[model samples]
Target: MSLTTEQITWLTKEQISWFTKKQTQTFTKEQISVFTKEQIQALIPQQITYFMETQIPYFNEKQIPWFTTEQIQALTIQQIQTFTKEQIHWLIYLQIQALTPTQISVFTSKQVLAIAEEQIPYFNKKQIKAFTPTQILTFTTKQISAFIEQQIKEFTPTQITYFNEKQIQTFTKTQIQALTKEQIKEFTPTQITYFNEKQIPWFTTEQIQALTIQQIQTFTKEQIHWLIYLQIQALTPTQISVFTSKQVLAIAEEQIPYFNKKQIKAFTPTQILTFTTKQISAFIEQQIKEFTPTQITYFNEKQIQTFTKTQIQALTKEQIKEFTPTQITYFNEKQIPWFTDWQIPYFNEKQIQAFTPTQIESFTEEQIKNSPQLLLRKEEIKSFNSKEINKYNLNNETLSSEIKNNSRKL
Candidate 1:
């Protein structure tokens, strides 16, 4: 016989155990809805497990969120699917944590959006993996904030791509650092733009190296402006090599001092030519010493013309000695006059040959006298005073030796 409403209400736990599953199923939703809250709480897991999914709405709304893990675990997939958005929002952390991955996967996108912030941190990786792309994007900023580094890192790149800008901006520095290189590479340009200043440094060299040029170009002006020297230093030469001139210029000037010789040298000629006077001077002396002659060639004559004597003379004696004749010819006299007396001796005959006669005349008498005789015209030779000619005459061993000895000290 079908269960009557009054009889169903009177059945004690012990008496309910005697009912067949089919007899229990026969209880109408109207009869079940009238049960006291205490009666619903008292139901055994096995009894709760056997309730027709159609009867789920009959359970007290207040009882839904309070279900113990054992009662929750007994819930059929059909019953789990019936969870209201309000029910999903009210599930306490421990209760949410207890939902099987399969049960979590059954949640609709609307239900996923209703998940409470405090409960987000408790989802297992298996449940996280089960989330749909649409469901993942529904996570609120507050929900994302509670995510542990490990929990956030396990999300697939594709799943991560679905995050809204507001959600992405909430990533903690540790969570940003926890991203794998490949996963980091998958960030959309819009998502990448939201990386706050504090989180920018959290990217490792490997993660920085994986960024696509298009993704990097979308970084906000302010975001690019705050990259500390150490962060810029972490970029791969190949990564840094792709920087556009405007993009390169956006790097903070204080950070400019940290560029290593190789990094400075890696800049394209067009990139170098774009430097403002201040930017040009921002290069550390070590970087200047490191500049390849080819890199120096990219500088306009005004830049070359304006270089302080100390800047030119600060180059290593070997680097000065090795300058291509063409590169030496590019230096203006104003720059040339500043060359140290020590640098005078390092210029090879070929480099000296490239100098203009005006340049030839600008050198100290001693420099002209010591130079390769082949480089000087007879007119130029006669231009030197008798004392300079005496020093030039190497066959006059005593005077030449005396000049050479003094040159070593100079």
Candidate 2:
């Protein structure tokens, strides 16, 4: 007779025990006669959970027939949970269509967690997202945190940069706050710059304040300069008002060397006047030292008149010391013509006597050559010595010929 649906719905422990005994070689024919194929077919729906849970060991030992995909789909949550790794894998592979959302959720949460923890790359994004919220929450804080940390740690520098900017805009405040200091340190300058520019509310005031002086000090010079520049704009009016003159001066002085003259001139009168006399003196000396000779000449005519004789003498000595010997000679030669009014001697006898006769002769020749009127009076002398030597050679040959003629007559 065909079994009723109610009969198929319930598989008792005694029935399972009877089936087990029947499968053994020691069982008698009466024991094996417990259920016909029709009865077993009716029993499948009811016994699926039982088969999945308790019957797997029996199936393995007795080499029982495999369940159809439809029968596997009928398995309960409890049944699916009890599956061994190999059974679950086979079920996933074979019964792919048989899984309901509920079954998939349960199976993934429990089974997939283990698989994912192994970091198998074959898992799809859809499969990863399929994890139930409850399953996700089931993970220990440390586990989830560690997994996130590992992902960040394993991220390439390029990936970290991309995520850092993206996370500032997209991640929840709590999520951003969850990152450890070491993780935060992975952010590149560009990433941090983006974060600061975006003004992420995720960074609590206290958290922002938590950056130590030493930590801020660790930033690159450019970064520090940028931060300080930003702070001038970012700080509230009250905070700005709190800045002491000394602080402002310190920043200005530190950056002044980098500023152009126009930038330097932008300082308020009071700010400009804040430079002590000693500082002003040092700055002047530095500027004077850097000026070229032409610039110095311009400055002497326009600016140096303001200085005392001692200062001018000091500047002159510096200029003289820096001049090349040839430059000094040229300067002296040019200035010597102007010395009569300055009461300087024109050319000392010792200086005049220092010139060699050859140099003097060359100098006199050059002066005459350079004179426009002297060129007309100068005569060119051709050398007659070549013609004389030729005539002498001819005479010697004729004399030698006469001597040979006389010897033959003899």
Candidate 1 regions exceeding 4 Å error are 1-10, 17-54, 74-77, 204-206, 209-222, 268-270, 321-330, 356-410
For residues 295-334, what per-residue lDDT tens digits would candidate 2 score against the true structure?
A: 3322221222233323333343334334332222232222
Model 2 residue 351 CA deviation (Å) reads 57
Candidate 2, residue 359: how far the Cα is off, in Å: 52
What tens-digit string does per-residue lDDT give for candidate 1 at 1-58? 3657787678775665565677768777677765654566566788877777777766
Provide the lowest-lDDT 10-residue window in model 2: 375-384
Candidate that would win on TM-score:
1
Q: In order, how many clashes per candidate? A: 0, 0
Per-model TM values vs. the true structure: 0.76, 0.24
Q: Candidate 2: lDDT of 175?
A: 51
- lDDT values, one for every candidate: 0.71, 0.39
